[model samples]
Target: MSEPLKSEIAREAEALGFDVVRFTSADAADGAGAALHAFLAEGRHGDMGWLAATADRREAPLALWPEARSVILLGLNYGPDGDPLSILGERSRGAISVYAQRADYHDVFKAKLKTLARLVQTLAEAEVKVFVDTAPVMEKPLAAKAGVGWQGKHTNLVSRDFGSWLFIGSIFTTAELPADAPEEDHCGGCSRCLDICPTRAFTAPYRIDARRCISYLTIEHKGHIAPEFREAMGNRIFGCDDCLAVCPWNKFAHAARKTTLSVREETNNPPLAELLSLDDAAFRARFRGTPVKRTGRDRFMRNVLIAAGNSGDVTLMPQIEGLLDDASPLVRAMAVWALSRLAPQRLRALRPFLAPAEADPAVRGEWLEAAA
Candidate 1:
């Protein structure tokens, strides 16, 4: 395709609500394999073992589909107006990742990617495929290569236009397109993102240990949360966005123009009491079209129980009390821990549930320890 055609496609992408669009030859992403190897060698990927396997393929986009000649990186800004991190101190409420505080980005981003790809195909001749986070595409590195943003020290892509709140998507195609100049890194001498991590998930500049990342634990880890990090999780019921929220660059971010991505009143700061009471069906209904539904009720509640333990509100004891008989042993176990942190009167009220729980040896031990 001619350079003019590429420019027109970019203009159309912007019109479709994408903040930035740039092109790169699929063969240009050669450094991805080595960086991924080093990242995996340190076990920094945590339980996300998929990254280790896709290292080679992710390194070069052409490897995924040899027929693809160009990759179009798309970025959408989802920046919030206020400090998303400030809500962390409100222990009685839940802190959701800023991106997740509105509509789910996957659905929003994928629809936009599809629209852009269709428009590109109509203007130029080529086979096109759309990918958001659903594919093995290394969006941050590719976005940097495409001039959409630079990957900051926190390892998330940050752009001058969208700050650190942009959602990345990509279109791999058979058309030859003019590529954009790559953006320069601007995170000079700034360690705010690294120092702000609750679990110190960053091992060094630009690398995050997914295992230690609260986002990974609360949303992706299916089993019981590792005991050591439970207390540090605070009341974040869904994904944690502390690192992204603390970035100084967000000051220039524009509020999401689309109301769909704007913060919903109920989601911006949900009451902890209300969130904990959601049964499976209610959880699904309430979180419909939202990212929290991805974690399912069990995993989400596991996070909630950890938060309840940290709440220091004896008034929540009754809600925590009812969870003792929850079918999932993980939920029951967390209830016992939350009970242990309750004030004396509330703890006394929990004794009846603890006494019957003795048949489950694990529950018995927790009950004995909390009662003592």
Candidate 2:
């Protein structure tokens, strides 16, 4: 496609609600692949074996799709209306990550990406593939190369105009477009993001140990969370945004403009008591269109139990008691921990009766640990 056509495509992207648009060659992501390989080699990704499984494809856009010559990166801003850190102190309520308070970004951005891709295909008569987060595309590096933003010390893409709140999407096209100048790193000497991690998930300036990340613990992890990180997790039931929220660049971010991306009132600071009460069906119904639903009720409740333990709200003791007999050992184990924190006497009183009946070794271990 011609340079003028690329400009027209950028205009169309903005019309489709994308905040930023840029282009880069498929080969631009080769350097980032080295970082991915290194991260995998150090076993920093934790249980997210998918990252290691798709390492080759994710290393470069060309490996994912050889037919593609150009990568069109698009960013949609989901900036919060108020200080995200404010909710962290509200221990009785769950502090969901801001981006997850709205409808799932995959659903919100997928249609828009396809629409833009179709337009590109029609105008340039080029083959196209669209991807949101599900695909194994290294979007942040490609986005940085495309001039959308620079990869900050937190390893997330940070833009001068959009700050750290952009949701990235990629469009791979057979037609080559002139690449935009890559954005220069603007995070010089700023360690705000690295220093703000509750779990010290950032091992260094740009490296993250996902095993300790609350977002990964609450959402991606399938089993019981390790004891060390549970208390540090606090009331963050869905995902953690400490690093992103602390970024100095967010001062320039505007509140989300798209209605679909706007935060749902019910999701903002939801009561931990209410969330802890959600059964499988209720959990699904409550978070239907939001990203929290993807974690499923078992894992979500496990997170809720951790928040409840840290909440210091003895009022949630009844809810914690109720979860002790839950079908999922993950939930039951965390519930035992929550009870021990909120009502140790009650936990001690019930240990004899509970421990004998619990068949699961993990749950029994939780009760045993709490009693000791």
Candidate 3:
């Protein structure tokens, strides 16, 4: 039987637009399984319980599928062309994560992975499966083991070539492909990602307390954002990128190949007024295929209202007026909270509309207190 030519397959993957390619023998990740277990036992995953439940399966690819003999880890670089931190000072605008500024990466990475896998199948005689954060398999450690990169202190894979801007995917197969030598830890003294967290989500050098993570708070957590995090959130309406942006390795980061990920002129720092005007339909139309879809309309508007409140721009009162009777009471309540932060005159002007409106009692109570 002819053995698979791993180097040839990796070249094909690079030609297919994958920035980095690597191969790892199954069970190579067993060494990192202990740290993963400790991470879960400490309840560091927050509400992402799937990470905990699938811990065993994730630590060992064989546990997920005994038929797999090899794992191919691929990294796609989506590094920003400019300093992502520059957007933070534009308080009038929403700051989107660099990864989210373009096409949905899952869609992009999966299609690329599939194309690469298909080419590999034509070259070899084994069955293959492709995944990009969609499976229980631990692609990070596997990528590190395969010499794609090292697991940064932030736990995301980082590379001298790609920085930490890589999006990882994998193709698991029954073929016995030769494995690449693993990369050693390069973050010996770097803690920039930890100190830069606005929410202080990092519990240690490498572990994150997802509950306080801004990405989790703005994108994942439902209901109201906890009061403590509201002020620190600034105007980041969708996700946080502080950890990724502050990494010194990003100096070597490459520019994105296409304008698709370029921040849209309107989206780059969307005026709080315009965002407040979006009803569910407008919100859906504006954000289709974007990562912002994860928040849904109501949650997104709630965040916008918080930003409006923080903007200290009393001129936004008119926009807040429209959302007072918004279909989502959560939005209306937040609107009231934001409006209250403005001049007493602005609050007085909104009293009649807010007083007669039959909104949620909790929200109404908040509105009434603001009126007082």
The most accurate candidate by TM-score is 2
What TM value does model 1 have? Answer: 0.93
lDDT of 1 by residue, 245-333 (tens): 87878877887788768887667768779977989999899888888888888888888888888888777888988898888777877
The whole-model C-alpha lDDT of candidate 1 against the native structure comes to 0.83
**Per-residue lDDT for 1-372 in model 2, tens only?**
489989999999999989899999988464798999999999988889999999999999989998899999999999988999898899999999999999999999999999999999998889999999889999999999989999999999999998989999999999989999999999999999998899999998889999889999998988889999999999999999999999999989989989989788768879998998899999999998999889999999999899999999999999899988899999999999999999999999888777799999889889989988
What is candidate 3's local distance difference test score? 0.80
**C-alpha TM-scores of all predictions:** 0.93, 0.98, 0.91
Candidate 1's displacement at residue 245, Å, is 1.6
TM-score of 2: 0.98
Per-candidate clashes, comma-separated? 0, 0, 2
In the order shown, the candidates' Cα RMSDs to the true structure are 2.2, 0.9, 2.5
Of 1 and 3, which scores higher on lDDT?
A: 1
Check candidate 1 and list the clashing pairs. Answer: none
Model 3 segments more than 4 A misplaced: 1-4, 28-32, 259-266, 348-365, 368-372
Model 3 has how many clashing residue pairs? 2
Model 1 regions lying over 4 Å from their true place: 28-30, 344-372
